[model samples]
Target: MLVYSFQGFSQERPLQQSKELPQRTDAPTNSQQPNNPNQDNNEKGRKTLEPRPISEYKIISVKNDTTHVDTALTIVKDYEFNYLRKDDLHLLPFTNVGQTYVTLSHTFNTTSLMPLFGARARHFNYYEVEDINYYHVPTPVTELYFRTVFEQGQNLEAFFTTNISPQVNIFIGYKGLRSLGKYQHILTSTGNFQVGFSVDTKNDRYHVKTHFTAQDLLNQENGGLSPQGVINYLGDDEEFDDRSALDVNFEDAENILDGRRFYLNQSYDIIKKNDSIQNNQITLGHVIDFTDKEYRYEQSSANEIFGEAFETTNLRDEVEFQEVNNQLSLTFSNAVLGRIGGLIGHADYNYGYQRVLIQESGTIPNRLIGDVFYTGATYNNTIGKLAIDGLAKINVSGDFDGNHIQGAISYPLSIGSISASVSTNSRRPNYNFLLYQSDYVEYNWFNDFDNVQTQRLAFDFKSKKYVDASLTFTTINNYTYFAANGIEVDQEGFENPVTFNIAKPTQYDEQVNYLKLKASKTFEYGVLGSSSDLIYQNVSSDDEVLNVPDIVVRSSLYYKDHWFDKALYLQTGFTAKYFTSYNGDGYDPILAEFYTQNQQEIEGFPIVDFFFNAKIKTARIYFKVENIPSLLFGNDNFVAPAQPFRDDVIRFGLQWNYFL
Candidate 1:
């Protein structure tokens, strides 16, 4: 950390020139010579009595200096398990800790030519606990909680480029990143450890880029009970199921940590650059990524703890998955009648293969997937004074199949003071939505992230006026739903257990709707000026999307130039969330056993944050306060013992920059 303290700061004044900028002209000409000598009657080129009084014409020119506008430099770091409290979120640091980049631009012999360069670095640590709620019984029990995580990451990139002409330039860049992580957890008294490393590199140039990535992960588990192995103790008979007990006994023997590697390369180039006359363009892109994974697990138990020799259950298993993906896309467009935009078309093709093997049994499962998409659209900026825009897409894939179209028209009104437009669009399912696999495992873990349905249609209307107010209304249909399986089972007498199904996790076909309103205003009052923005979103879902809220509102306020020679500023904001219940048909089998009949509704939560800043010539300082009230909310969906309670922290930092 660095600190900077300064006093009596003076602002730098800009230098001025007496001469004015030269007038813009396509060609240089003699303005003093009139086309018609008789009309001007100034006696063109005629030397009169006293040297014509020697009229002065000063064509003022000044050298333009590079202004380092809005250059920012800062050090930021934080520890976060996940964004939005999700289990699948990968922890990354270094370049992810809200780093600030400083940019500098310079212009010489201006033919509208400018060059820029920038670099940044950031780092942090993250840890999380997993599988505490369900283990052999399908999930780890809260009583069996344990910590498992270690992560470190670093990323660096520097780029230099200059524009030869506006919208056309050449660039050179270098980028590199690395990630190392480790995790530890206990199942049936055995320790499970996982460690991994990843590295990535990228290079980019005009109209083309390339990327490469590699990763390796290792996992190990020991001292766990194995299936068909000796068992000494089991949990109380009340909450424990025999099958679950068997699972715990075999957890260690079934535990496997595998390593995975991935590589990707891609490029984009302009096959044809548009010209002034026809405005034609063609671009092509290609990408390929491959992955290989292998895992092994061994089972062990403490059979001789009490001196008596007991049976030993040893099980060994190994699994591997290999995947390769390739994609190619080509686009073409041509202007129409050299007026309204003509036609644009694109085609994309993709193929992928996945192979899985269970080493112990020599069993293999393989799958092949292919995809294609074709799209075309037309646009006209000026169709008899009415700006028009339209887009359409058709997709064909193993998991996705649909067509989407949208169109919009807008024209300036009331001397350009206000403009309004309405558009309608439709969407199909994502590539992952069509495939439904509840038992698929990834990265040697059984965690799942999936969606039920796809978006079918949407209509939106937007209105804006320079900057006073903005309003948007959208109606959506066939919205997807992701519901966790909710279940209930009788814990009493063995025979005929009565099961009450709660919420079946399914992508229910429903109409989801939302409306957004935003307004902002600028006032030049106390201290220099102030700006405020308010936004609201209303959402309705057919089924409870776990932790997502139905209504959200955000508001922010800022006060500046109040102290320290106009160097200090303050910002404050608050967010409010409201949720609704899930509406589905029945209880899902996967969730039926983990939940109780009486489901509790989660209450809304409000969060507030405050920030203050001070700027100096070579340094900047800032202080931030988050979760001011420290409110604790509860949720039963998470595997952790406690929902993320209110978090309160204060942070202050300073940054300095200098060039050599």
Candidate 2:
């Protein structure tokens, strides 16, 4: 079904102001001047200067919620110490650092109103506007993240931010990774560069944030293992202990995804309210976003594994998608009414290949170009101890038909918080599913699909004293997916070589009901502690269009203590993750998408890892041994149909922060 883990909600929340830190002036006072002879000698104080608190450095989200920088070395920090710099509890990485991840879970809440571009697998590390974070700091701050990759490369992310003036801030950062994997023709290289600035007017009447990002993700694909290689790998033969010795489908194939984006958001106060009084305030806001992206796959020669091609050599498939959007909004806020806003937006999108394709069956159009106008409203308010938020949007006039509505309510409990939400969406499928042209003759397709409609209701409870749990129920109509049509070949000498297939887009005409329940908890006893997360899912459908594991679990046990007279903090732990067996989706390197397959059921296996982490001052170091179980018991883990999991490996990394 080409389903992957969609993280986070699409709804925008009300921006919250952060508590201001005490301002410290760098200029010396007249009394402290060396020429001031009247200054008391005793005032030449021997007091030691204390460093600024971490809370003075703020990180701001697109929604305007602000949080300070955290340098602490906690278990959560250890979990986030990876190539993506995010917790991978619900994800499984391939052998290389910059490669795509296998989604162990899925979330349906999406923010984009338009159809997304293709190459969905390569976009996990791609940063969107909402993924970017702004910053405010008392002084210049620098952060560096470094980790070792598979074979001969390293992954690093460096960021620096400073305030140009009291009201202006700027930041620049770059994350780069290059990994030569242990397997044949599986190298990955990627980079992301971002520069941004924020400005606030002295009168507090105007505020703006702008950023530009350029990114490229490249991977050399081998189309997984050949049949003989799979047989050798499954046989656990000692001669093939070295992965490089194994045979791959093809060696001269690669794909690249590159994009550039410019974003700007600004707001002006039309009716300002004094801080000392309780009154209504009004603001006018505008946002502009533009992005141009392309995905290309090239092969030295057409391989028989993917079927016949129009041309046998030097095959290339490329697609492009460009979009620009502008929005204007007016908001009013009060102590009682909280905040209410209305917005109108216009979007222009163009997606397709360079030229139209003329085939015997029909003529495939080269482009889908259109403009859309949409209007939406947002409301956020607090009545007594309960908070409420709602958003609704619809396409007023456009070639595309889409709409979204969401509502949420939350209440603070004595220990934690309880929240409930409901959301519904109707949108078109991705552009790739609609129209595509490839060098392979069987890969060309054009289809008119209906808008996919979905609805979800969820409840969540968060607390440390009690278990953190969530329950969600969702229903989907017009589910679209990719399926394979197999073509068997009979050879005289070969014992029925692996079957080749042509993938096609298909839609189910029935409703799918899905329910999910998840829970997490942590327990501590002296210096030893354990944390666990469990998920259970059930899917009910008349047709098998969607598939996922029924259950997933991750648990970790650790010991923490301060060593060397509290000079260093240390934490050591072991984590294990497991899921039930299911018909895992197969990956298509040409399209860079996962397609549904039921030929074989992949048995779930547990992946165990050991980690040792230590914190000294502002630097955190990590050492880990991943996939320990694979080392102890022969290697039999596979993330996809033909993709094998990573073997045991020792890796280390560090995160350091500097305040200047």
Q: Which candidate's TM-score is highest?
A: 2
True-structure lDDT of candidate 2: 0.85
Q: Which ten residues in a row have the lowest lDDT in candidate 1?
A: 112-121
Question: Model 1, which residues run further than 4 Å from truth?
Answer: 1-365, 383-386, 396-400, 412-428, 436-478, 487-505, 520-524, 528-551, 562-598, 617-620, 631-642, 653-660
TM-score list, all predictions: 0.45, 0.92
Where in model 2 is the C-alpha error above 4 Å?
A: 1-49, 489-493
lDDT of residue 522 for candidate 2: 88
lDDT of each residue in 1-660, candidate 1, tens digit only: 011111111111123211211211212345774454223225453322211111111111111112221223111111111221121111111111221111110001111000000000010111111110100110000111111122343333332222222222222323233322221122211112222111112222233222222222222222223222112112323322222232211123223223232333233435444465637655454545444433334445422211111224553334344444454545454454322222222222221124343535344333324333433344435555566655544444334344555455666555343344444433433222222221212111111223222222222233333345545555545543323332233333335443323222233456555555555544544544344444444555654432223333333344545356634333322322222332212212111111212243434444455656554443445566645654232111211111112234454544332210
Residue pairs with backbone overlap in model 2 = none
Error (Å) of candidate 1 at residue 459 is 8.9
Question: What C-alpha lDDT values do all the predictions have?
Answer: 0.30, 0.85
Model 1 scores a C-alpha lDDT of 0.30
